[model samples]
Structure formats: C-alpha cells, structure tokens
Target: MTGRVRGALAAAAGALGFLTRVPVGRDGDAWAAFTAAPAAAVVPGYVVGALAAVVVAAPLAVASDLPVASVAFAYVLAVYALVGVNNLDGVADCGDAMVVHGDRDRRREVLADTTTGVGALAAVSLVVAGLALGAVAVAGTAPFVAVAVVLAAEVGARVGLAALAAFGSAPHDGLGSAITEGAGVGTAVLALALAGPAVAWPLLAAGSTLAGAASGAVAVAAAGAFAGALAGTAVVGAWATRRLGGPNGDVFGAATEVARVLGLHAGVLAWTLS
Candidate 1:
C-alpha cells in the first residue's frame, strides 16, 4: 500500500484502540498516527456500531418473545461492554463542573477532581436512563430497522467526537489538545465525509427484508439520528468553550454520551413520524 494508505490504516487502528475495548492499535506509533489525523476518529465507529448492533439484535432475532425491558438492558450492557465507562466518567466530570458556581478556573478544577459529587451521580443516572429509554424505543421496531437505528446512533456518536476534535479549542495540555491542536476545518470536513455513508447503512440493511416505505423510513431515521448527534455535540462543545475556556477530554466524552442518546431517540422519532 501507499504511504498515505498505511498512515490512514495506522490512524484507524489507533482510533479503535483509544475509543473502544478492542485489543489492537495501542502502540505508540499507532497513537501518533491517530492523533495526527482528525478524520481517523470517525473510522472506528463502524466497528463499534456493528458490534453493538449485533450484540443487541442477535438475542432479539433468536428469541422474539424477549421482554422489551430485557432487550433494553442488553442494549445498555452492549454499549458499556464495547465502549467501557471512560466516556461515562467524562459525563460525570462535565456534570460536576457545569453545576459548580464559579469562574472558569474553578470549573476546570472541578473537571479534574476525582470526587464523585451529587452532580456526577445525577448526570450518570440521566445518561444511563436515557440510553435505556432509547433502546426501549428501538425494541419496538422491526429487527432490521432496529439494527440500522442502533448502528446509526453509534456511528453518529463517533462523528460527534470527530467534529469536536476538528473545531474545538483546547485550553490546556490533555486529550482534547492532542486532537484539536492537530486538526482544522479541513479535517473536520473530511470527518464529515467519512461519516456520510452511515446515513445509507439503514437503507442497505433493510433492502432485502423491509418494504419500500419501511426502507425509506429507516433512511429518514438514520439521517435524523446523524443530524441529532451533531446537534448534541455542538451543544456540549459550545458550553465547554464558554464555561471551561475550551474543550477537554471530559467534554469530548460527555459529547459522545449525549450524542448517542439523542441520536437514538431522534432516529426512533423520525421513523415513527415517517
């Protein structure tokens, strides 16, 4: 392969390693490549989303009579299994910082503090609950449609990360700076291009099993989910920039969690309305 292709591959591997519990791409070289390319952050979503989708969908396919609550629980489990609690920690940190009534430095200190405050407890609970509710809605859909929606939501979550990495400013040396410092608007556009195919995954997945109307609805749902994910990401980025001076690792993590939940609900709503 060409040098650029090899670099892209390494970056993708690095992103996968950093973003999920997968065992590959942890080496220093892979990480270097990953941090160098902002678009790399978008590639791993396919792997993660596909894996989570299968984990949730397989049981439902095998046992169609499974309770919706059980399916929702499985969905939540699959997400934590694939992505782990690191991002959730980010949600907690951001939550604590957000509720603190102080200047930027004080809030930044809160972000760095490891103490589990009431805000952290509340934020994590709301996120977990939101994810479960989204899964409950997904369970009500056709199997293929459910798979599409789940996949779309996961990919959208990653796309949100990429968007923040490209456009967000970082005030200190940390994970956010590692990405934001190396990325620019061009990289952000590339990230969006990489994410564009996710919108079609639903239609392609449903082509053989779903009717034309259903397939179209799935398409609308996927698009809406992707849009919603970006919107959620923007909200977090804007807030972090104003309150904490810029994006940080915790901000990125919070954005991912928020984006995924919003994307899931948005997809279901679109599908229902369509």
Candidate 2:
C-alpha cells in the first residue's frame, strides 16, 4: 500500500482501538497512533462500531418472537460494548461538569476526578435507559427497520463528534484538542456527507411501509432526518462550547451520546409523520 493508504489504515486501527475493545493489530501501535488521528479519520471507526452494533442487533431484531426489551437490551449492550465504556465515562464527566456550579476550572476538575458523582450517575442512567427505550420503540415496528435506524443513528452520533471537532475550539491540551486542531471544516463536511446515506437507507425502508407513500417519501424522510440531526449537532456544539468553554473529550462524548438518541427519535418521528 501507498504511504497515505498505510497512514489512513493505521489511523483507522488506532481510532477503533481507542473507541472499542476490538483488537486492531498485534501491537499497541494503533492506539498510540490514535492521538494523531484526525476527526475525519475517526469517522470510519464510528462506521465500524455502528456496523458492529447493527450486526449484533439485526439477529435479535429479526427474530419475530423476541421481546422488544430483549432486543433493546442486546443492541444497547453491543453498541456500548463495541465502542468501549470510556465514551460513557465522557458522558458522566460532562454531566458532572454541567451540573457543577463553578467556572471552567472547577468543571474541568470535576471532570478529571475518577469518581462518578450523583449527577454523573444520573446522566449515565438516563442516557442508557433512553437508548434502550428508543431501541425498543424502533424495533417494535420491524427488525430490519430498527437495524437501519440504529445503524444510521450511531453514525449520526459520530458525525456530531466530527462536526464538533471541526468547528469548535478546544480549551486545553487533551484527546479532543488534537482532533479539534487536526480535523478541519473539510473533514467535518466529509463526515456528514458520508453519514447521510447511512441515515437515509433505513428511513427509506421505514417510509416505504406507510400507505400512499413511496420511495419519494422515504427520500423526504431521510433528508429530513439527516438535516435535523446535523442541525442538532450544530446546536449541541454551540451550546456545549458556550457552557463548557469550548469542546473537550467530555463534551464530544456527551454530544455523540445525545446525537445518537436524537437521531433515532427524529428518524422515527419523520417516518410517523410521513
């Protein structure tokens, strides 16, 4: 392979390793190299993680006899398991930071603490429960539809992270800081562009199920969902930046988790309306 290709591959491996427990290489090189991976480079890692979730959930979803809660439980477990718990840790930190009454320094200190506070625990529980409930709702319609929506939603979450990295400024030196600097507007646009089709396909299938609506309606719904999710990401980035004094690892984590939930719900709502 060419140098660029090799570099990209290495970065992808690194991104995946950092994002999940999945073994990428024989050594720790990829994880070490992950620090330099750009926001765009990490997009593929998100795809891999999302695809893994789809694979795990698809079987459960397809089993018509399966309970909705079972499918949801299985799917959520697979997603967080594949992506690694650190992502949730970020969510917890951000939660603690959000509720804490102090300046950026105090918030940062709270975030840095390893102990999970009441606010952090509550935030994590809410997000995880929301994910499970949303999965059940989506899966109730059809397994295939649920799979597609989830696949898209996970991608949407990562896309939000990329957008944040591309557009938001990081206040301190850390994991998010490297990404913020390395990932440019071009990368953000590319991440969104790549994620659009992923979000659309599932919505297309769901929309087709509605009477009087055809593929065109699917197109409309998909477009709306994708647009809505991006808008949501922008809003999250803006709000988090203001509240947290710019994007951090915690902010990115919280944003991704939030986007995932929002994307799934928005897609389902669009389908319902159509």
Residue-wise lDDT of candidate 1 within 1-274, one digit each (tens)? 9999999999999998888888989999998898899688787778877777776677777877888788888878888888889999999999999899999999999999999999999999999999999989887776766777777887888878877888889989988899888888888788878887878865665655463346778788888778878888989999999999999999999999999999889988988888
TM-score of each: 0.95, 0.83
- What is candidate 1's CA lDDT for residue 4? 95
Off by over 4 Å in 1: 203-213
The positional error of residue 230 in candidate 2, measured at the CA in angstroms, is 3.6
Clashes of each: 0, 0
* Error in Å for residue 173 of model 2: 0.8
The superposed Cα distance between candidate 2 and the true structure at residue 51, in angstroms, equals 4.0
For residues 1-274, could you state the per-residue lDDT of candidate 2 as single tens digits? 8977787677677766665567773256664454454544345435654665465456654566777677667767777767767768878988787789988788888888888788899889988887777767665644444545566666766677777878788989987787787777876787767676665664545535533345544454444445555665677678677776788888777777777767667766765676
lDDT of each: 0.85, 0.67
TM-score of 2: 0.83
Local lDDT at 191 for model 1: 80
